[model samples]
Target: MTEGTIPAALERAAERFAAREALVDGEVRLTYAELARRVRQAARFFEGHERVGICSPNTWHWVVAGLGALYAGATLIPVNTRFTARETIDVLERAKVSALAITGTFLGTDRLAELGSSRPGTVLRIPVEGAEVPFDGVSEWDALTGLDSDFVSPAKPDDVSDILFTSGTTGRSKGAMSSHRQALSVAEAWGECGGLTEEDRYLVINPFFHSFGYKAGILAAILRGATILPQRTFEVRETLHLVEAERITVLPGAPTIYQVLLDAPERGNHDLSSLRLAVTGAATVPVALVERMRTELGFDTVLTAYGLTEAVVATMSRPEDDANLVAHFSGRATAGFEVKLGEYGEVLLRGPNVMLGYLDDPDATAEAIDTEGWLHTGDVGVLNERGYLRIVDRIKDMYVCKGFNVYPAEIEQALGWLDGVAESAVIGVPDAVYGEAGKAYIRLRPGAEVSTADVLAHCKANLANYKLPRYIEFVAELPRNLSGKVLKRVLREENG
Candidate 1:
């Protein structure tokens, strides 16, 4: 791997594979040279900006804007498109974002207008799937073209490249800071493990807001010279059609992604033989699912991985591993990283790729990474005789719903805003499509007439779509211990 910054890597890729296909989005296509020019144009557009925020779905515009910020020596903060205005504003404020690339009125929601006067300095409104509602003082996203005199700032390997916010069990989200070196190193490691090459065409269904999509999906494609096809949303038929139509060779997502592909009634109608590599993780993986993915989906290589935002790619299965090993274990520690069990079998990792620290929070940083540099992950896992890690329990009350972590406390805090509900508890339950789904238990105030529809409506407005609970049940009283703490175990058992 080249010991250079992301922008430098992009420059190298442009020169090495100038005419190679780099991006494909809807009707637009760009070669590596053209993609580099587009990124420079975006960088020139954001000349004076410092920290940049992107709050849109996966698109070619998102790719250019995000890379443009990094290329211009600004810290990139990718905001979840599913978040409401309030939630998005919280992250922007936390990061002190000076420029923002937000889509105009998407899917009947004017995210820009919703942000109101609290909006950041510069806004690049990308016109996506919805009518562009009139908003004041915004620049056109697609109109950016590099001026001959525009200067692009260079970034160092150690400079922070991105600040990705992740919710914790404490109900507040923390920004995980990664330097250019860490991001590029992890992307290269992932690409090498998957054997991503110039011959491969990757369909990135993962959202760009998360590491799996941005780093593993897009960044890896840049480093390895794979053609990237961004799908803004995941639908059963459309996804299958993309695979068959584009001859997508490399696809990585959660187990649920493969499950839906297998369960699709029209699975027989599509020619998915071009699929070469498939990576899935972040939730339970049944051996049968792995076997079926290999046998039915016709993927030549299938691997599972275990990672958190703090350490992007801790453990991952190699291509040669068997289906049973791939299903049961999350591979061994990758190169340049060491994984060991701390007290009570807690998984601890030490690596150059681990996040530098939480943004602007020294105390929390100290608590997470120890004096010896081992990050004390709150996940419980057991290493097999051959050192493959199998995650068994999460000490934090968090669950993976469709590859994204859903902390119950975050949803519970959102539910607290409802008018009628006195208290609520959220838990994860098994789902056929989404590996796990959220189930909320509401304790209404005396004589309160809040219905399930009301709870769902409030959640839809405040929380991201992934955080919304699929099940809502009202309760007279929540089971509590003598100390007045809600017994979540009881709720899980009763739910069962």
Candidate 2:
């Protein structure tokens, strides 16, 4: 495969696996050669655009358009499908996007009309099945893909590949600019860490906009010549059906996804024997869940990885790791990365996969990456003698209760062991006695009842009084971003 750019990697994949199945969406399949041909054609259409925005679901169109933009030497910007009109406009304007490739409608929302007149670029609508959306002046997908397929723009390793906007938990989201070299490095690291083979059928449920889905999911698959089955959204029944139908070999998502599948009544009805590898992260994963995924779910290997948008996949557990290590730790640093702890117990990373900088935010970029080139992750963690890293919590998520520092991730991990608790989040709230106390928001299993007193009693047995939650509130569900991370800022704002 080519060393730096995604389009170069695509060209190599097409040569090696020309007739192999490259991408699969519902009723849409493309071989590597066909996919490469379309990408080249779309590249010709995007020849003049400096920055191209892609707003679509996890489909063949999204993958093709993104790679095409790269091939045409345009920096790709993936817009979150869940963003509001104002948020979308903000991204388009901030990125200085000159063109957009978007689906007509996704999940009952007319994406074109949502941006409306606020968009500052040319819009290109990707036609979806059974959708007839009208637009005044926009290019169609057919017209773009019908262009000449021989044109290929030159892109260097230092060129910006994509600008990924961070989830605005702390404040306004900053776009993390990643170069072609960084993107290719992360993709190769993920594939090597996961032991992905060309024979594996990868089911990508993560959103295409996120670094995990785009770089680790699609780009990694292309690097290894693995067949990509892109799912628009996560649905337990639908995923189960796809797993059986496609004989998927590699499946990765958050811990909640596997938990839901284990709890499904119809899980046994589906033939999941083809599932061999599973990778998950984003929250506290219980050891029991890891064991169940291996023993009950029939997965040969279950791995846990840790990374952020700035560095795509820094640490990941190997296939030989035990369930406890995989659950309790985020694994050692991957090859080509140096992971260390700061003076305040914050995790710091230095590697090729580290992003170039935040787009248009020099101050924020300087604050993030220090003079020594270390990316301050702002996550509290501990490195064991064996070199495994255990994430305690976000440095901002730590709170003082009665003069003792308390980490919400520790409390959340303890809560996961509770019988009826399906999911939980702890935020520091104002307390009369202590300076700040933790308030636990919990979502119980369906039809399982557990009161606040019961939860407190369980915590008393498992945790110290200072570390125990001061208050408990039962909720139907926890608010999560598109990436499946609990919106702790939302919880803190609501309950603070």
Each prediction's whole-model lDDT (CA): 0.83, 0.88
Off by over 4 Å in 1: 1-3, 167-170, 397-496
Tell me the TM-score of each prediction against the true structure: 0.80, 0.97
Rate residue 66 of model 2 by lDDT.
91
- Residue 334, model 2: lDDT of 88
lDDT of 2: 0.88
Candidate No. with top lDDT: 2
Clashing pairs in 2: none
* Residue pairs in candidate 1 whose N, alpha carbon or C atoms collide under 3 angstroms: none
lDDT of 1 by residue, 1-496 (tens): 2348898888888898899999998788999999998888888877777799998888898999999888888999999887778889989998999899998777678788789899987998987875575666888764686354244557889999999887433457789999999999889889988999999999998889888899998899999999999988778799999999989999888655675677678899999999999988743465666788889999999998888888888898998888879977888888478999998678999989889999899998999999999999888788998889987556666788889977776677577567665567788988898988999988765566898888899999988888889999888777742212356777777768
Q: Tens digit of lDDT per residue, candidate 2, span 1-496? A: 2357788899999999999999999888999999999888888878889899998888888988999899999999999889987888899999999989988777888887788787646777887645565677888887875688997668778899899999887888899999888898888888988899889999999999998899889999999999999998898999999999999999999888888888888999999999999989855787777888999999998998899989888899988888788889988898478999997899999977788999989999999999999999999998899888888899899999999999999888888888878888998999989989989999887778899999999999999999999889999888988888888999888864
TM-score of 2: 0.97
